[model samples]
Target: MLERNEALKVIHERHSTRMFLETPVADEDVRAILDAANQAPSAHNQQSWRFIVLKGKYKEELADLVLSKAADFPKPSSTLLRLASRSIHSAPVIIAVANTGELIARGGDLFNIKDGSGVDFFRIMEIQSSAAAVQNLLLAATSLGLGTVWLGVLVLIKDDILKFIGEPKGEFMAVIPLGYPGQSSRGPKKKSLEAVIKYFVDE
Candidate 1:
């Protein structure tokens, strides 16, 4: 195998997976994924990210909660809602990610101010840190030939999910489902760089 440029291959191959096989992911693989997540860099090294892995009965409970919320919406609700409900039960592992939140005092010290704006900045940093960790987690899973999907829809039932996971008041970020692929495909093509990116250069 060509060792050089393999990271780019992994990045290009990783896609948001939907359907998954019933086969179980090995415990070692799960641990490796988490280890990759833990290695992500954080603002001020606070490492505010936290995770809750749901499998077996816990996965069932997640589907129940999401479905309960979906029922309140219009009939034949969003496909995303349907997918979110199905992912928990269908995937071998579902990992819930959140932020512990920056300590009020730390935030004040970081920004050198004791004000609400400082708190806001701290909150954003917390999310950024968690997001980086989650990206690492996804890439690692992809390298291991595991399919994964980042389910941000979990934020819809944030309160209920937090309570279920026993982390009341935690900033729910996302739920990631991982397993062997049963059915999945790369979604719509991404926009060209010229269409979305703006370059500012010194002239």
Candidate 2:
């Protein structure tokens, strides 16, 4: 178990770095982060999460895809686009995580006959489980002196990205860009704990 101070340090220091240095992240460190993600819990151990690691020209292509899609929708800030561009250009790695919808299922031994059930339930579970795993991956990166940013904008161009990454249709939840921080960043602003939390008691 991590000591309280060590855990808190990781949490407090973790930030969504938009600018990254030119240095490339070592392959071993990338493997370590992914391994940490694999350690995340899954529903019925289905482990439905899949990932595509993007770099070089592929990353630039993805950024263009995002920018084009964003233009088609409501006008977002120029600053946001610049930040996204900087992130993609400067970061050494980007991980695209997808959910394999069809893979969730029940299993049984050859000798025993058991009806398969809870596949749908397991799909939902995969989302929650994969999210937790992503969180772990982010924390692990921060602990190792790296930076990360979660981008939900990819969902808008999910189909394009899936095709770009060669992921099968209907499989992916989110994409996260990771690297060393070029510009120090404070995490996003958040509501106070009192405003966001509620407690319930059973009678």
Best by TM-score: 1
* Each prediction's TM-score versus the true structure: 0.91, 0.82
- Deviation (Å) of 147 in candidate 1: 0.9
Worst 10 residues of 1 by lDDT: 71-80
TM-score of candidate 1 versus the correct structure, residues matched by position: 0.91
lDDT by residue (tens digit), candidate 1, 31-134: 99999999999998999888898999988888878877886666445556777888877899998898887543488877678656677778888889999999
Candidate maximizing lDDT: 1
How many clashes in candidate 2?
2
